[model samples]
Target: MKSSYLRASAALACAVVLTACGGDDGQLLLSGTISGVTKPGMILTNNGGSDFEVPVPANGTGLTRFIFPNRISSDDKYDVRVKSTPTNVQECKLFQNTGRAGFDVTTIEIVCTFKTQALGGTVSNLKNDLILVNGSDRVIVPAGATAFTMARVAQDAPYGVSILANPAGQSCTVANGVGTMGPADVNNVTVTCAP
Candidate 1:
């Protein structure tokens, strides 16, 4: 009787362990920003490929993002498209050309250029931009501003903040008096001037 009870307990323990590791419903965490000179409200579409659409975030800075709960698939490739309401040329160009999704973050960084605004102006530009870097260990210089911003949706996860320099592909200077992520805990930022 004692032997049978011990075997049953061991089996139950094994079953619990397997159950914890056997769920295929794992979630894929998607986080990134999209910017352009287009209107404040632009809709980013997955175009029936997958279930995702990130509208351009308000704040008139052209920064937008979304998080999808579905698991990412390696076998499938999505034809993601960004659709503007009336269609702005700059926004279309920025999203259509720079927009992409993948499992690798480094490749994403290499292929993507962060969006920035025109120097000394309140306009959106994507031509000359830089990848927004989380400056925890290294100092990231902005094209214009003294400090940049870092935004996050998840708790305690390492959030990556970004910005694009001159959207025209010109090396411009960042505006002064701008603030960046402070210390190791700043989760969101908003800059009045370009960087």
Candidate 2:
């Protein structure tokens, strides 16, 4: 009878170990989509956890879905966010910045826009007035003015400078003008005037 009781106790211990090693039932998945990623390998995080790098498709291919690495429990709170942006030449913004992981949520989106740069520069050898033209906006630099600045110019936008009213018998010529603005500030644009 003692041997039979020992065997039953061992069987009970083995059952308890198997139950302890079973998979958890509380794990939930999280996923979403991303747009405006020109380059590949964007990263995302969960409540400051480890980053999950996103895969980029080949050229001419469309973007792919982003999924988290580990499953989260229902009791844990998650704030999904971008860990790092794409290495492309665009500026990305995230919609639905923060959300809770109560269930399997997958409605997050990221949109990106072409980054803008400043268009500005100094005026030198100016003996007459001139106007810098960007779209329909214009800025007049006085005859004796030595410097000028234009800000918030859109990327890849065309710009030019011309003599609005040259009354000082001086002809103005632009050195670094009449070109599409790049990703950085165009501060080297010089308008030189001479008699």
Candidate 3:
């Protein structure tokens, strides 16, 4: 009994000291910084392993950093990348997130930016300064102008370009002005300000 107790204690000591033990040995932490990660639904992966869903702050959200729950073995290769992003997020890119795990992994940064696209089209006829509006955004078209472009709209957002004011003695109507902005610019809107 005494000999077995000594052996068990020695094994326990070795495990605690992490010398030749199997539990929690030769592991390294993985973490990094984040910015512009609004909304949610952002998934990250390490060496194509388990998924790491980024947390979104509710009030006064400052989700600027993350520490992955899973740890990688030291000297093992770690390839961290963004698997997906929220609908509003245009793109989420990872920097300095791929390398061999060491005693101290370098700082990784994931930055995300929103999506936006230009909104504009063409106008015809001899018209005075005309006013146009898309939601809250408005544009003034001078007389004899061939083309016009309103303020940029958020990608996939609704846009309704209408004639706010027409030139004197002339009526104008816009066609194909009500729709959702897609991935590319909208240049098909036609404004006809004439008799």
Candidate 4:
């Protein structure tokens, strides 16, 4: 009886050890590559849990590994995203938003760019000349003009245009004239004037 009890105890201990070491359940390693970031660190969140401020790779073009504080279950849903981006840089976007932890994931990639486009619009019912201001830059739309354009505006740049003065006794206002620039040119800005 004593020998049998000792054997049972040994088997139980082995099972406990294996369970503690993630036996039968495969380990999940999460990693990915990032580009267009030259900062020291960025925040990454897993499954919407607490934010993990991981250090950005010094090379600015390499894989970034993330080690979860606790062991995550296999086949669990993982939604990794950029909690915050580096300052003074183009926004970074994630390609794959959702993934399953069936195996180690390493194909995720992040890309960033600083390209921008122009913003312009048409002027309707203009009985007088007026000036359109976007920041320090201004464009003068003469009477009987149909359109105006602001070139080389930065992406995601906010523009608000107002009529400096309308000499044609026309009250002028902006319509669809307030917004941030997107990836494409903004040509729908409308400045309508009424005499």
Name the lDDT of candidate 2. Answer: 0.69
lDDT of 2 at 50: 92
Q: Which stretches of candidate 2 lie over 4 Å from their true place?
A: 1-41, 48-50, 54-77, 86-97, 101-104, 109-118, 125-128, 134-138, 153-171, 178-186
Candidate that would win on TM-score:
3
Q: What is the per-residue lDDT of model 4 for residues 76-115, given as tens digits with 9 covering 90 to 100?
A: 7778788877553467778765778777776667665545
TM-score of 1: 0.30
> What alpha-carbon RMSD in Å does predicted model 3 have with respect to the real structure?
5.2
Candidate 1 lDDT tens digits, 1-195: 999999998788766665454433233333445544223334444435443445444575544454444544332243445554323322244332233344521111101223322211121232333444343422234444434343322221233433444333454333332343222344224333333
Query: Stretches of candidate 4 above 4 Å error?
Result: 1-113
TM-score of each: 0.30, 0.50, 0.60, 0.43
Better model by lDDT: candidate 1 vs candidate 2: 2
Q: Which residue pairs collide in model 3, if any?
A: none
In model 1, where do residues sit more than 4 Å from their true spots?
A: 1-26, 37-41, 50-53, 69-71, 85-91, 94-195
Better of 1 and 2 by TM-score: 2
